[model samples]
Target: MDSLTHLTNNIPWQRLTTAYGRGTDIPQLIETGQYEELSSLIEHQSTLWQTTPWVLMILLQELSKQKPEQVSLQEIQLYTAVASTINVDEMDSQHAVETMNELLDEKYLWPEDEEDDELWWEEEEPRGYDQEAFSSYFSYSYLLLKDAIPVFTAIMEENDKLAPAIQELLLMLQSEGERAVE
Candidate 1:
């Protein structure tokens, strides 16, 4: 198997987690070019983790290494998945909706006893937040995307079908203050 096929299997997934679960499923999903699964695993209703950008960086590096003439459907799917995953929206309404859904699912809005409801809300407030870690994730994501631009540009030149989406991704990367405010 190619190195990319085995890339995820080699990761220390025990120490990492995605929006869904342990990171073990990631390598297999990417290797198989399961774009839908990958999107669900990393994109929809997901919270950004410290390891998220690292995974994206590795995937982009692997994708960028493929020769344009040899670009496969699987490669394109993987590229699209990674691109969608890292393209953070300037307005994070999706994240807000996810948070609201989680709160509802956990019944955080209604307590078993009214007396304990206030305490629940108080405890839910984030404490000791790590702003640096959040910033680092975005910074790393930006740097990785910047490094992959040349490779993507070359690929886009060869694959016109991918040009528009790739161009959008490049623009997104170049935009300043694209990060969502917490």
Candidate 2:
């Protein structure tokens, strides 16, 4: 059997849990062409578990090997779900602002007056989630599946439903690329 088939069949679903329930149902969900169910399982609110990215990588690899004309809506939805989970647009703006602020600080330049600085610092809340783990997963997933991007892009171009998610994925890829080059 192919690697993708092996992966889907062999994932330790009983020990794994998604936003909903046991992950064992995931392979069946994909096999049965249950896009919505798969989407819900892979993306739970603002949390993308480590397992979700692994599943997504396998799905993308499977889809990428297929002819462009043969790609299914369920597959595209998989891409959309993965893109939504990453939520790169939200991260992009926030990261840009933070990076800009850091650069200014390093150069001894302040964008705001002393009072504004104090107010902003006071308002800055501690992140309640593990941002590092999320970032690491996102970077690793993108790098692992970068080769499949063009396939996703083609799907996005032909289907309006995929545009938003594909766009976010592209933005994340671009941002990651820039960071790599720097």
Candidate 3:
């Protein structure tokens, strides 16, 4: 299968692109020839779902975080490959709600307890998250993540541990401070 097809097999980033949509930067993040940031970010974001979202949570984290720099374009593509839902497509936000609902069901994000031990139990699929949280700002749903990229980009700026290359890229890419956009 083609590489894009392969990446989607496990996470379906293209489906995410089609489902939620993203901005031009989404592609740039994936195609920037950056590997360490993409890989590390993928690991960090993936951990969120390791217990619940499994795949969905990682995608969310990726959308939430900024891509580090001095990596490889292939690596960025790999990261995006796994994303199946987005906050915004090319033109407007779409499938933001459905993607979250599907993620809720697929990853079991909502839990009776915030510290549920068996949250990571293996099964045919995961449980659903709190649907009452379907929103564009407060909620952790796809649409909210997508709609709030500008805010998150601003937040990424003040982060300290970020690599200098990545920091510079963010500043240069309009992904830093208030001017950083969604």
Instruction: Give candidate 2's whole-model lDDT.
Output: 0.56
What is the clash count for each candidate, in the order shown? 0, 0, 18
Tens digits of per-residue lDDT for model 3 on 1-182?
74433433444332221111211123334434344434333333323222112232343445454443322334323333323222223213322344443442434343334344244233334343132322211123233334444643454455344334334333332322435454
**TM-score of every prediction relative to native:** 0.59, 0.58, 0.24
Per-residue lDDT value at 157 in model 1: 94
What does the lDDT read for residue 134 in candidate 3?
Answer: 24
lDDT of 2 at 69: 57
lDDT of 2 by residue, 78-178 (tens): 65556655544345333222221121122222232333544433544312113544454454445445667787788677767656766666655554556
Mind sharing the TM-score for model 3?
Answer: 0.24
Task: Give candidate 2 misplaced runs (Cα > 4 Å).
Answer: 87-136, 154-169, 176-182
For lDDT, candidate 2 versus 3, the one ahead is 2
Residue 80 Cα positional deviation in candidate 1, in Å, after optimal superposition? 6.6
Evaluate residue 68 in candidate 1 and report its C-alpha lDDT on the 0 to 100 scale. 71
State the number of backbone clashes in model 2: 0
RMSD (CA, Å), candidate 3 to true, equals 14.3
